[model samples]
Target chain A: MSRQNFEEQLDGLHRQLMSMGTLVEEAIHKAIKSLVERDRELAMEVMKNDQLINQMEHEIESGCFRTIALQQPVGGDLRRLGTMLKIVTDLERMGDHAVAIAKTTTRLMAEPYVKPLIDIPLMADHVKAMVRDSLNAYIAKDDQAAGRIAAQDDVVDKLYAKIFRDLIEVMSKQEHTINQGTHLLLVAQYLERIADHVTNICEWVIYMTSGQKTDLNK
Target chain B: MSRQNFEEQLDGLHRQLMSMGTLVEEAIHKAIKSLVERDRELAMEVMKNDQLINQMEHEIESGCFRTIALQQPVGGDLRRLGTMLKIVTDLERMGDHAVAIAKTTTRLMAEPYVKPLIDIPLMADHVKAMVRDSLNAYIAKDDQAAGRIAAQDDVVDKLYAKIFRDLIEVMSKQEHTINQGTHLLLVAQYLERIADHVTNICEWVIYMTSGQKTDLNK
Candidate 1:
């Protein structure tokens, strides 16, 4: 393959990845919206759309493998392709977590919430922004932006901890709340995990740009 | 690199991956043991050893990338290498789940028996077996074995659902059990996720051998 052709292929793969990112971000948003509004139909939609995200991952992954085989890219080119592989895996996982959140929404649809859905949605918004920022860093090859995105994981973690504690307290006081409270805790955890995957993306962005593996997950 | 040299390099990478797998299996065992025995030191050990797993993932991933760049392997060889990359991600995630279980152990150290943890340890044993079997299948290129391992995930899921219901019942009945019960629920969840990762490895195993992407996770 010619250098220009390889560059075009990489650009195409990047575009596909961006589209997958958009789908994942939508899944996260709709999953939370389904939960907050108790919209079973929207939750089901997130679950069904996850298959499309999975299919996109498979397509992009095959594209990466084919390009690597034909182009034999090394150094920076190799790293960029490799980062795309890792990023897709992370994005696919984020999609799965969204499905889990949607499942939780479905499970809890039978009863009223123990508390208002405040922190969980706030946490989701932070993670969604982190996801968007991380992808932007990937496209711009901005290691500094990637570092800043990873730092936001701490904010997500704090929100999760607060949600956990508050839910545990609520469940302790009211026996009826235990079932949904635990499920809500899992929802917060799934969002927190989505943020962690975004942090992994940030780490990959930094590594692809700078050739240094920084543990931003800490 | 010569064909013989490349084969040798691939074999070396495989050995490294197996060692990492063994470490992951041991981490799962020790994490669950720490939880069941309330051994803080054992939990600490599992937490400490997780760094080793992460480091190994980095090393092996770099090795895979270097080999792929140097050899420009295609077809089956390329798939095998790609599978290794994916398998390491699954193994690293299992290690992280082990760390999560260990962290839960530390968090719940102030508590006493929450129904004696019979099912959680049993669930861990099953997932640990699934991990071992999945790696064995990878080494042998036994897609049939991979199918069996993926089937075992159903067992793990069933166990997890049972644990979730049992704990929710206990916590709903006894307010004091709420905190520990929730932590135990997370532990069971970590185990369930580890099994899911094992299933992913199984899917990769099938794909590597057959060149077909099957969703064994379903």
Candidate 2:
């Protein structure tokens, strides 16, 4: 109703979004941790809890619609709400990837790992950092911070390339490793995709602040 | 703006979104055509033309913001614009998946036949149909159509599983086929992801009409 009330609602939405991001960030960490430690229970926990991320996404989206309908927010306020809609989807997808990674962990539980998973876990850590930084950038409305965080995707990309090549070598030399190797490769690909979603966040932040459309992933 | 004017504006946005959706659908077709036919030039064309999809997404998005700021569209109108904004991103990501599939084609171009490749093309056809039908469902505001189209994703998921298991068999049997097999597997995964995006469009369509959130992919 009042401008002050609308701002408080917007502020509340921001806090909820940050909390959603935290849930996703934790999902990524726990999923990858399950992978590294071969903890199927933790992996199952991540998979089971994915519904919460989906629920939060729906709730936040409803809030966006209600704010727009009631407040008729214009200019900066409108853009902020619209951008949060996109950002939460990205975060929810990151949650899906995390669940995917966790599923992979469960699938590979019985098999001895094809490799030590040094780079995969490392990539997961880097991706989790990107997710955090992207949310921080969004909360701060820091355009420069968004760009800085997006550029970090390159590191994740390189790590993926490394995992790809090494897995290929293993699969080629040891035929028995092909099945497990491919699964590991998909896990790496999932992390790479999560990084790409973080870049989407950065792109949305820049659009929110400057009204400029640029693909940070590129 | 009058309600009539807002309706006209919404019509314009719908046409633009369908046009963008067509570009994405064609990209997916050509990308798979290149892969199935082994036409490197066609694959390259798909990759090169991705920028056009990206450009159109920005144009439609900017227009949304313009309509929102100037018109202060409310209720269904505001939600429509917000939903279109989300739909375009989903379509654009499908375009990216098409581009990724084309890149995979290029990477595997030098390799010879990996089986007869019947199922992969079949999967692509089903996914393309899903993309088209999802757009149709959105245009019609037919919530039932959206739900039905979203259900088709199960077929694509089943196809992906078939491709995955068959490819794993191929790679496990022959060492040299490992690289190309993995690439093919990734292509299938890309198509599967595209189907998932199409499901997202369906979910958004239902939400746009009903003002309710549902995950059709589930």
Best by DockQ: 1
Candidate 2 residue-wise lDDT, A1-218, digit = tens: 99999989989998999899999999999999999999999999999889999999989988987888788787788888889989999999999999999999989888898668799989998999999999999989999999999999999999999999999999999999988999999999999999999999999999899988887877
Task: List the candidates' TM-scores in order.
Answer: 0.99, 0.97
Model 2 spans > 4 angstroms off: none
Candidate 2 lDDT over residue span B15-44, tens digit each = 888898889989999999998888899999
The sequence of per-residue lDDT tens digits that candidate 1 reaches over residues B75-108 is: 8999999999899989998999999999998988
Relative to the real complex, the DockQ score for model 2 comes to: 0.72
Model 1 preserves the real interface contacts to a fraction of 0.76
DockQ of all candidate complexes: 0.85, 0.72
True contacts kept of each: 0.76, 0.74
Q: What are the Cα lDDT values of the candidates?
A: 0.93, 0.90
Clashing pairs in 1: none
